[model samples]
Target: MSSTELPESVAAAVDPRVSPVRVAEGETLRSVVLPGLTLAVRSRSATAEGAPPALYVHGLGGSSQNWSALMPLLADRVDGEAVDLPGFGDSPPPDDGDYSVTGHARAVIRLLDAGGRGPVHLFGNSLGGSVATCVAAARPDLVRTLTLVSPALPEIRVQRTAWPTALMAVPGMTGLLGRLSRDWTAEQRTRGILALCYGDPSLVSEEELGHAVREMERRLQLPYFWDAMTRSTRGIVNAYTLGGQHGLWRRAERVLAPTLLVYGGRDQLVAYRMARKASAAFRDSRLLTLPDAGHVAMMEYPREVARACRELIDDYDRS
Candidate 1:
């Protein structure tokens, strides 16, 4: 098997145009205009007032829809909202194309600050996971509980295979990326992308496929797709190399919110072994391992993941 056979855990890569963005009546997604960027946001229940609301953030190449399953479950008590980090989902790319992890974290923090809900229940996966951790640490006042699903923190054993995505962050790749695929079809992009993100490609339903295909087609039609991809790529890559400083370790140590660190033992992008270090970082935390799951456990096992989240919510309520 090619090293790039891409273990089944990564679903974002299956389709370049794929996004988790849709609207159900009464459900609305509003893009808040912020300095340097705009965020594609969807909200379910926003009236918690004094209760701790939930916030969801997706990883590389992911959109708000990725949390569709988990959001509905938590919406009742959590009053959750998920945002597409600029450049990946329906959200537009940054004005300066500055997609560093800190940059992304700032975007998240700004959104949370604007939400006006104090110290939310935070959930982040992969790249978003790293950003979420950073946000919680930097502004503990804004985060009550943190739930990280396979966060992309630095590891002693980084995947050499993941370097290609990082390379796109280089100065030259952004322009070249746009030129390389002028006439490429959306279906082609989606097929190539999905092949990389999903452990079991067959698990992707037809509707999901159509959504991705259309999203990619829509985004690629614009001139900003490459910019979004490259900038966000740079941000994600820079996050993996914090040089023993404010990386995941330090952030975890400073995070005051009760944390729940989760890992998919079968994940390819992020090695499950790092869970140990993660556990050590959080002063208040627990670990859950999904042996058969891939990169995105919530997507693969929504009910099980939901049950875990409910457990946390119950714990928070009691506190």
Candidate 2:
């Protein structure tokens, strides 16, 4: 769809494809074809001057717009582009229907190679964080530094009270969710989701959340929405449980990039206690605890997140 034709929510989340950030004006929107679908690409001119660029990936059921507000601010400090992971945002689903972490990482690698950015500053959250860790570990050459916000690593054991992930894991739960709320409408689904992700449940305004709710309604109409979500959940559970070399923690240990791990002291999804183990996983990593933030801290406390992101960059650039 044309930029103007896109929904107001989507529009608010990302600049028009023509709006360049860290790249030259001549740069334009491009698509990189992976097995099942294509990734919609956009770039901004190097507003950071000569600084290295960051590559951002959003969590499950999220899109590139998740980074819209933070990008312009960070662009001056570091070049960056955010991506919509397959089946979530604008990106398409995987060929194997494999929503596994490795599957997502492979797609990311393809996007990086196709988009022509090298050794990027990597960032991710939740499912995307797990995928990002896999990418950095599998191909360290492509990542210069790493920043993960509430990344879903392999739990030492399941963190208690993470109801969302727990619900996802319950057999037949999605179908049950779909059946119980099938007639409830997409707007309701979207609002319900936002409430689950945010501890305070007010980070998303009724107006703003209404837009997201509409977006969800439109997307669910697509054939793959439910399947993609189910597969993506399966992928996360599978990748999250991997042992030895294939696990998220093992990959984190292999990541040579200086890493910054951000966790909300109140985050319900990834759990705060797991943050300590995550910090220890990366040899060159340090932890930044957000005492009052929830799962999506960047969205809830944009200013603090921006400051933390800057400090991480400073340390990376200095060392």
Query: Tens-digit lDDT track for model 2 on 162-236?
Result: 655556656788888778777887777776777667767776777667657656755666566777787788788
Q: In model 2, state the lDDT of residue 143.
A: 91
The number of clashing residue pairs in each candidate reads 16, 9
With a 3 Å backbone cut-off (N, CA, C), the pairs that clash in candidate 2 are 20-44, 21-44, 21-45, 22-44, 22-45, 22-46, 23-44, 23-45, 23-46
Per-residue lDDT tens digits for candidate 1, residues 1-319, read: 0012112122233255443445654355766777677777777774445546788999887777788777876665688788888777767677777688888889888887775766788999988898898999999999888999999887766766566666788999767765887667888888766665555667889987887787776666555667667777777667666656566678779898888888886677778788898899889988888886677887877777788877877887799
Any idea what lDDT model 2 has? 0.73
Error of 1 at 17 (Å): 15
Where does candidate 1 stray beyond 4 Å?
Answer: 1-21, 24-26, 46-51, 174-184
Off by over 4 Å in 2: 1-30, 34-36, 42-44, 159-161, 167-171
| Residue range with the least summed lDDT across 10 consecutive positions in model 2 | 18-27
State the C-alpha lDDT per candidate: 0.76, 0.73
